[model samples]
Target: MKSTLRSELYKALTNKMLYIAIAIGLAFWAMDVMENQEKIKFFDETLQWAVNSGLPIGTGHEGYSLFFLWSGLAPQTKGANLFYTVWPVFAAMAYGWSYSDERRSGVYNQIAARTSAMRYYISKYIAVFVSGGLAVAVPVLLGLLANAMFVPYAQVVQGLGAVTNINFLSELYYTAPWAYGLIWCGVTFLCGGTAACLCFVVGTSLRYSVMVILTPYAMFVAIDALTNSLRASILKNVRLILSPLRLVWSSPGWANPEWWVFLMLALLTIFSFGIGYWQVVKHELA
Candidate 1:
């Protein structure tokens, strides 16, 4: 199991698709950074801007920490919007579709001749999960570091947490901003992993490579649309958004992002693993 996992991870991490996802995610992050040139300019000429712009010099708005990330002051940045909109594609793009190829091409038979099919499938799942998680997580971490280079970690205001749409975990954002940021990173990782796992299942049936890769993104968009429609039509009081895509955005979203998200993600991951294991080991081995 250890050897199988290590081998699969090597291929997954070194895969060109992983890098492509990272590059795409970072490009969106860069768009936000570029769009915020006015704020960056404020950093350069705070004294000059305070006089003319009429905005407070350092009221935590000019460049609060994590400003360039999806969760920062620029909640509706065009690039960030685009990035989150298609993040599931990035997740699944990493290593999710490989399983379909291996199964169809009979590579699994060769692999199973040496190691058990159970070990091979388990390793593949881990590789997909890690690569998928990294595809999204790396860009967010890099975005934070990049934003840190230009902006200071201005303490998130306690009273303004709700005002800024950080209400769900507003206390965490208010007390320890860095921890709050890390929590979002964790969220991104889990969401990405689950998205990829679901795509892996879809890949079982999809023959077209492009559609196999795109399965997760389509599902996220469809589910998010359904959730929105349901919320508007019937479940008006329920503030918790069901779509993971919506949860990826930090600000101006989820006034009550319930604790159940972690539960849902956990169950989804288990279901994917269980189904894959059952399909491969029980039926294929038989």
Candidate 2:
């Protein structure tokens, strides 16, 4: 089982599209960092515009003491925002292809002849999980690197401590490139893995495979569109980036979710894998 799983994993790793998407993400992050001139301008202009226009400088609609800074290069932040937004879909599609192709081409039957369906399914999950993680992380890490260098400019002008406290330890621990990257990547990985597992369930239970793959992502998007303001607090601490990404710019960037939110995320992760495992064990792999 281990050898069979390993071989299957090795095959999944060779996908060119997966690597290409990751490369593009990294390139965008690098470019965003290298060009910080606009980010500074946006930050300055937005704050001034807000104050001049008589809007509260750093508060939410409810008049909560929220510090909202508009960086000149909203595009860079938007890029980071979009990067996390679209990455999970890339992961789901890439990993989904692993099984989709096998099922479509009838290659799965050949594999099932020698290995258990469970082995194949589990192996696919492991391989694709790693791929999804990299899809989210590579670019985020690059962005973090860019922020580490060019971010100083953003801090200096914005009065780094004015909007929010930037303790060196906090940056080192939670807001640092690696730490923030991991948190964001974890969000994408879970979302992607959940999407992939749902696809697998759909593959075995239904004929049309696209529904299983696209439904989860589509559901959240629709909800976000419908519920803009309420979603900010709901998704703010979900650790599920889908929830937060929906309102990232609207809400405070560093909003720490309640502990219960993390617990819920953990539960959801386990539930997704558990469901996938159950389906794999019973799934008819032809």
Candidate 3:
């Protein structure tokens, strides 16, 4: 299993389309930051949209503005949970190509005949996560670097819409803090991995690979829109799509999330892995 997993990881990393797509994403991200240097115009629009979407507009509160800024800007940031879309899309494409092509070429059955099906499944699962992580990490690091050096991090950090006299470290540490940034990035990774794993299951069954690739993303969008239609009171009390990103608004008196929510999510990931393994182990009618 370990050897197979390592080999699969290598194949995933060497995928030509994945490499090209990452290069294109990096180029676009660089251009976006440079053109919007010192102040991204979209930050303000994002803030207004949050207000319109029912984020509380507290007056005379010192923390409210900062809270609003984080809530709004996070969605557009490359490393954020809301941007999990970027990670999963490429992951699904790359993994789908790997899985579907090999099966079509009879390489899958050949491998299964030699290796345990469980090993093959585990190898693919690990490879998919590695591929998804790289898809997210490369562009994210570039965006963070560009934001720190060229773009006015202070303006974005402070929601001020103007560059201020703040060092990059202070902008990063004091404004949002590195700990918070790490958590947000972690959320993005997990969400992306979750979506990719789900899509891997679909790819094993779907006729058109694109349909499998897009399923997770479509579900997220559909769930997000559905959550928006619910009452604000209900939405705030519950965790839903991008709900962790919405934690910038968790009321002071509200109860902390039950431990069960975390447990349930962990179980979900485990279950998904099992499903992916099962699919690979069974003979397909194709």
lDDT: which candidate is best?
1
Better-scoring candidate (TM-score), 2 or 3: 3
TM-score sort, best first: 1, 3, 2
Global CA lDDT computed for model 1: 0.73
TM-score of each: 0.87, 0.64, 0.66
User: Model 1 misses residue 64 by how many Å?
Assistant: 4.9
Per the 3 Å backbone cut-off, how many clashing residue pairs does candidate 1 have?
0
lDDT of 3 by residue, 70-112 (tens): 3213433333333333545654565644676566667888887
- Cα lDDT tens digits, model 1, 109-205, are 8998899988898899989999999998888777766667655556655554432443446567666777777777877787788888876566357
Q: Relative to the unseen true structure, what is the C-alpha lDDT of residue 49 in candidate 1, on a scale of 0 to 100?
A: 68
Which pairs of residues collide in candidate 2? 38-73, 39-72, 39-73, 42-71, 42-72, 43-70, 43-71, 43-72, 58-66
Q: Which candidate ranks first by TM-score, i.e. highest? A: 1
Per-residue accuracy of model 2 over 1-286 as CA lDDT, tens digit each: 7887688667756777567767777766665554453655556577678888999666222111111112111233455555545554555555555666577778878887788777777787677666655654556545655555534322222333222332112343223434433454455455455444444544544445455446445655665565555556765544332342232221234333434334534654566567667665665643
Query: Each candidate: what lDDT?
Result: 0.73, 0.51, 0.53
lDDT comparing candidate 2 with the true structure: 0.51
